[model samples]
Target: MSDTRLKISLASDRGMIDAALVVLGTVAEHCSAPLELHFLGHGLRDEDRDRLAHACDAHGCALVLHALQDEDFGDAVQVNENIPLVAMARLLLPRRVSGRVLYLDCDMLVQGDVAELFELMPQGAALGAVRDFYVLDQMRPGSERPEKLAWHSKVLGRSEVEGYFNSGLLLLDCDVIRSDRALMTRMTDFAAANDYRYMDQDYLNVLFDGRVFYLPQAWNSIWGRDRLRAKTLAELTWLPDAERTPATSKVIHYTGPNKPWKSQSKLLALLRGRLPALMKWRRAASGRYA
Candidate 1:
């Protein structure tokens, strides 16, 4: 069982450590499977690492820390100059870790048994993820929206329905990544060729192309820019009717700029009654250890 325990990977910087702590605390509260957490970042201070290790220890989970510097990736990493180097950490997971691992963004909270997600992965799917709503909108341009460029298509020169998946939460088959150097090379090449609108996410969609297994939205409920456009999973036609409500969601992702931590942000206020779970995240972010 120890060998098969779920492995979770999180990448964080100074600004996101609090959010990461909140995620860790939430997992402590609801996740029932034996687990291991891997933290990747360029500036995880010794004290912070100690604190994180202690928190996981209290939860009876194991923690592994990788203090990486920007130079480690050479120039293969792609992100805005303003984005933290840690933003590229997910790209390194294939080479840095072993076995199947789930990559989760720090700006999310676990609300149910995470092992359920792990168990739901279908065999031969290199990765499993929920559809990114904003990307879906771009892919399915409508009345007011212009069609996406042909380059964004799976066929490259031709337009095809190549859905995009968010990288924020991924059930990765690390063995596949380790064995497929061509996949890694192609992703790096793609990153170097053009500036992606969504950083590594764009590269991931391009690299995987049609290989991704789209999980139910309930697994990774995302918060988009215009709440009116995607206030709930029900609003997205891409989502299955069965997984529509917040009550059924296993995770809530603060995907856009308006984070729950920004107590004063008007965007957070828009969440209104939908943010009771955020209160739990906030408590965890404060280092309360749930």
Candidate 2:
């Protein structure tokens, strides 16, 4: 048992199969830790499973499938949404007494050693998330609506909430997560009751308010229009480069409808140029060493 090696998992429906594969390929290339990929939800068809298995074999990583039982949440309802799938996946993952498990969304791509995130784990927190940039109390001129504001307030659990987090990436202490079913139940209940503004993110903010450790924005950078308008790729400090490569990024979350796989993102194009070669080298290295 290697203490430094971490177990990582992703939750996704069938629509994210390609994204998940891309994410896995990226992780296998960049991370030096032992990796585990779990597929949750109904969309994981047989063909998808076979493709995932082939990818895992190519990288010498373990891939497992744990179908969510209706009994797990006491509901026969199937959750195809990313937010709820994320929450349910964390709650149902197999427990490990000592090692850490990092839960990443399918939309993310890794650029560095994710094992480093385990070392930065806070003492009492069961999970960690990066703050979302769009969580503002005062809505933009055209975006403001009383109902929307009220929904955001309820989702955040308060109107004056600080630093709303993006729930696409999470680092969980397996020991704490396995034992904290009560908190998981509470989160589920909150999601069921609230017409959440941001789905799972809203539930997480309301449940783990002020408890989750705030990591650097680089960990889950949103590559949307606003970020591009605020700063160009040259000005973006988090991008890996000759002089300023990130020392502590565990994952790179591509949150929102826009993703690197799509043709619209300039940032994705830049990353795609670099990530594939790295992935190929890692695959060869793993074959030789593992």
Query: Which 10-residue span in candidate 1 carries the lowest summed lDDT?
Result: 140-149
Listed per model in order, the count of residue pairs whose N, CA or C atoms clash below 3 Å is 0, 0
The numbered model that scores best in TM-score is: 1
lDDT of 1 at 47: 75
lDDT of all predictions: 0.69, 0.58
Residue-wise lDDT of candidate 2 within 1-290, one digit each (tens)?
A: 34444677777667766767777787778887677766565446788788778888898787667655445554423344434443445545434224467777776667677766666667767777765645432343344445645765666667754446777777766566556677755644633533454545566676677677766555665443223423333453442242122433335555544444544544554564434433433343353322
TM-score, per-candidate, Cα-based: 0.82, 0.69
In the range 30-147, model 1's lDDT, one tens digit per residue, is 8877888888866768877877888888888888888887665566554565445577678778777787888898889888788877777876678888776554555433422325
Cα deviation at 40, candidate 2, in Å, is 2.1
Deviation in Å, model 1, residue 284 alpha carbon: 3.5
TM-score computed on alpha carbons, candidate 1: 0.82
- How much is the lDDT of residue 285 in candidate 1? 66
lDDT of predicted model 1: 0.69
